[model samples]
Target chain A: MTIDFKQDILAPVATDFATMDTFINEGITSKVALVMAVSKHVVEAGGKRMRPIMCLLAAKACGTEDLEKHRKLAAIIEMLHTATLVHDDVVDESGLRRGRPTANATWNNQTAVLVGDFLISRAFDLLVDLENMVLLKDFSTGTCEIAEGEVLQLQSQHQPDTTEATYLDIIHGKTSRLFELATEGSAILSGKDQYREPLKRYAGHFGNAFQIIDDILDYTSDAETLGKNIGDDLMEGKPTLPLISALQNTVGDDHDLIRKSIATGGTSDLDKIIQIVQNSGALDYCRKRATEETHTAIQALHELPNSQYRLALEKLALLALNRIQ
Target chain B: MTIDFKQDILAPVATDFATMDTFINEGITSKVALVMAVSKHVVEAGGKRMRPIMCLLAAKACGTEDLEKHRKLAAIIEMLHTATLVHDDVVDESGLRRGRPTANATWNNQTAVLVGDFLISRAFDLLVDLENMVLLKDFSTGTCEIAEGEVLQLQSQHQPDTTEATYLDIIHGKTSRLFELATEGSAILSGKDQYREPLKRYAGHFGNAFQIIDDILDYTSDAETLGKNIGDDLMEGKPTLPLISALQNTVGDDHDLIRKSIATGGTSDLDKIIQIVQNSGALDYCRKRATEETHTAIQALHELPNSQYRLALEKLALLALNRIQ
Candidate 1:
């Protein structure tokens, strides 16, 4: 059965979602016109507000009644996410995100880079106002790790020798680490110390699964469905999971092809690379791994008490997994 | 009197400066090789470490003998400065800083942007360890303003109508804000509440004078002397103080020439524009403004107690003004 996002997941926290969304708009208000303009453009281009929703859901799952602080935290999470995307576009040199012109495209790399910095600083500024030292420490360190993860991914770029363990490290930093912060940060704000670990675990595994699925789609999905063209990662020479797994499963020309493709990025061998990544059972291994991660993530959610919020969180994980199936 | 940097300014805090410099080296240690490499290159390429030296001087002026926490604060200030420079090079698309290859030049814009981000996060992480909420709030707010200042400058780019008031706002956000943070942060760390406002005022004015002098030098100094080419700002169509002052003082052909130069950036009429700027008394106006700012900065220092550290701070401000002479 197909699980509808609004009905099965986001329904429970719809009010909080609206509140958080409003808070984000208010939070990005700046004295500088350009900062506000670029921030609005990128924030509006946001897809689904998944991280903030996860934050709200985790807050509710912790049995917190006062979500006013959680709403602010959710807004901070979204701003951080938006800031990274603004920079990521500059790094990736992409013009469109979610079918809209990116900040880099709308203005220039200078504006995009500086505005991204503004968003990050503004996010931290708001986080400081939360007046929670524990939460501040969490975000301060978490953001550092997030940056290191990004740099690590850059270092790993075009290096075909990158391992699965290294790949996990890359994905954890680039994608899952923020998700961990969203849920873990909510638990911190809720004053639910006991829930922090389990929430972090659930989000971390869920993030891993989510990114793996995204990487898979890079090899499989067409532009019409994914908004990203096929072989996009290979084009960039990014040694993502499909390429890594394909290298492990193949030999001779297939192995050399995957390695060369990673070492020398481009979509010149797009069809053959896609064909090998599919026929070599690499997609099957990746799907199985994604499913395992999702299962672990949902299992961690069991640590919290039964509630509609918890159910929604579980459904969210399952829904992500369903994309692959 | 010739104010030698090492003898007149850095001498008082020489030992503390040494310790603080080492802390910066150790503080930037990263698990990611590229992060470390790029961070080390840029941090090592730093010139005079003026901001940190000011931080150290301010802490010493507070009559704080321990000098331990102040060292860390100074290091944090330098890291923040380095981070901005890294991002600034990317924004300006600069090839060299202080005659050394920029991170963007050495690696790529992508590396520079991400590494700069890592530096910012690491700086905040270290600040969090300082465990001063008031200081954290100051820095968080200060960084946001710095970014806004940068965006404001970008917004005013190539616009001939930009006023001195707008120029002040841009310099305050981009330049003075960090100086304010450095000295004010030192006061905050020194636990000297009474000195915070005065220190902030002093640094704010000093930063303005420094930027104005730098802008003036853009028209007067060349690559061999200043390490920056003459007309570099004009090449980018930056509406700096000299151009603003030139526009204010001229009219008819002279005014139109300056305005056109600003509106359409290039060094095509470099000789003519330089001749106009000098003959139009724009340089005299900028010098007078810089001197006035420096005097106000020195006046603010009167609030502090009489000490050698305070003397060094005064000398530092005077030494900056001496550059144009």
Candidate 2:
């Protein structure tokens, strides 16, 4: 079931993604300097451009002749993603993102939120030209699902009773849905149903695995490679799956300490709690779960025809898993 | 034309808008606690519910038979507005809105942003039920326009070079587009073309006057009526039309001081500058401009058939003009 992967898709896709940012710029008619500053700052700061790459790769994989449409869609996805990030930074009260001061932190929260909104709105406008009503429905639904996921995560924050299923629901809403839609949407746009379902499933599983690994890295990664402070989740009071798993498996004072640490969300005792979780094999357990999901993710690609895109996607899943360790 | 403006339309619209908070409970699958908390916090907080009310009133003015659709649309508009606010508060670093601790301030920025995204997504879900592709298109476009407006506003924050035309463009993007959409969307949803164009113009002008009045109120309105500290915008360094126009009208050191105030955002000499602006007749000038817009707004409604909703809308315009004073 392994597919051949290549980085060529990466370069052209990256280029197109760069070009897609233009769509966001096209209808922005305001003379607001801060809007331009924050928007340009966020976009140019550079993310993996994962969503747009998925759009282009999916479109190419589906054997679509029109790269232009895919390029536009890809840009819209990135804009949407960036918009969410601007908003997310504010939500997290994050001062830094992708190694720079966040829009909210750098300018103010109002601009960040509004700029994010502007981007989200622009994404829809970009998609409007594609002339597919169903795509609108799918994208709109994805936007909402992402939001619901965020709310789910927020609700579950600092609650010891938060379950694995609830966590899964949150991940699905916040991360996997958008990932799944990126490929699914590309396939839909290409009018190629043959590869659509499999591509979507593969992307979804990969996204789930990806976010799990991200959560793991939050515990395990150094600041240099990760580009963010390790244990930021803990500091922010987010009880990731690994932490929750450890809490559930603990006994006596271990359980008491875990509960208090999570409740306090990184007091002086946070170091001790991190050690307890590390020793408790929660990290190992979650990492194993992520590995299993990664395996399942690769399996999800079985229906897609062998191609560089398919292989690259499989490699992507593996890279995500390996990156956590 | 004077139209009969009824409290029934507004009252029930407000009630339904209020009830939407509990509607999240209907999403039985997610973390109910989070949903309840986010929804309750957002809904219970005071808002003008202007967009939704516009939708309702527009429908009523058009003599639409199906108030139910308009009602749902109203809820959707409010939800969208709420979502933006959730994100906006985080971006603005605003601690209070309408005299209540903002969602971002009360919960955390992350929760506020995510919850806002969730509500936005939920809005699309509601829009989907309306089952009109055009409505979705309209809403989606409006969403983008709002974002563009926001970005424009952000970009314009400190640039004293912003002209009247530029100012109008920013205001239209930031505020009026939604207002116009709300009125016209209601008419469109209700299939009332006769009122649609006129109602849209009415809403646009009204919203323009409304925002100008708000900008003027920043200097003139006391903390109690404005529900925020006076000159908060000035402190934030947001150069609204009053300042921009005043700067353009004044000469020499007065202009230089105002420009510097805009750049430094009224930090030092806040009172002295406020005095200078007042003495320079900026407040009076802005008020006069707002009143002019208000008159034009009222004039736009002349084409609508005599109805209570139309009159309420007209009164709303007048109220907007007079509120700051």
lDDT of 1 at A216: 90
Per-residue lDDT of model 2, residues B91-175, tens digit only: 5788988888988788877677667766776777777777776677777787877776766766777777777887888788778
DockQ agreement of candidate 2 with the native complex: 0.51
Q: How does model 1 score by TM-score?
A: 0.99
Superposed model 2: Cα runs more than 4 Å off: A1-31, A60-67, A93-96, A105-108, A192-197, A221-224, A248-257, A267-275, A305-308, B1-32, B156-162, B192-196, B221-230, B241-279, B305-309, B322-325
DockQ list for all candidates:
0.90, 0.51
Worst 10 residues of 1 chain B by lDDT: B221-230
Worst 10 residues of 2 chain A by lDDT: A1-10
lDDT of 1 by residue, A1-325 (tens): 5889998888888998998999999999789999999999999998999999999999999999989999999999999999999999999999888889999998999999999999999999999999999999999999998999999999999999999999999999989999999999999999999999999999999999999998898888542443477787998899999889999999999899899999999999999999999999999999999999999999999999999999999999998888778
**Best-fitting candidate, scored by TM-score:** 1
Chain A TM-score, prediction 1: 0.98
Fraction of true inter-chain Cα contacts (below 8 Å) kept per model?
A: 0.87, 0.75
**Tens digit of per-residue lDDT, candidate 2, span A32-85:** 565667778888775777777777877877767667888778777777778878
Query: Which residue segments of model 1 deviate by more than 4 Å?
Result: A222-226, B222-224
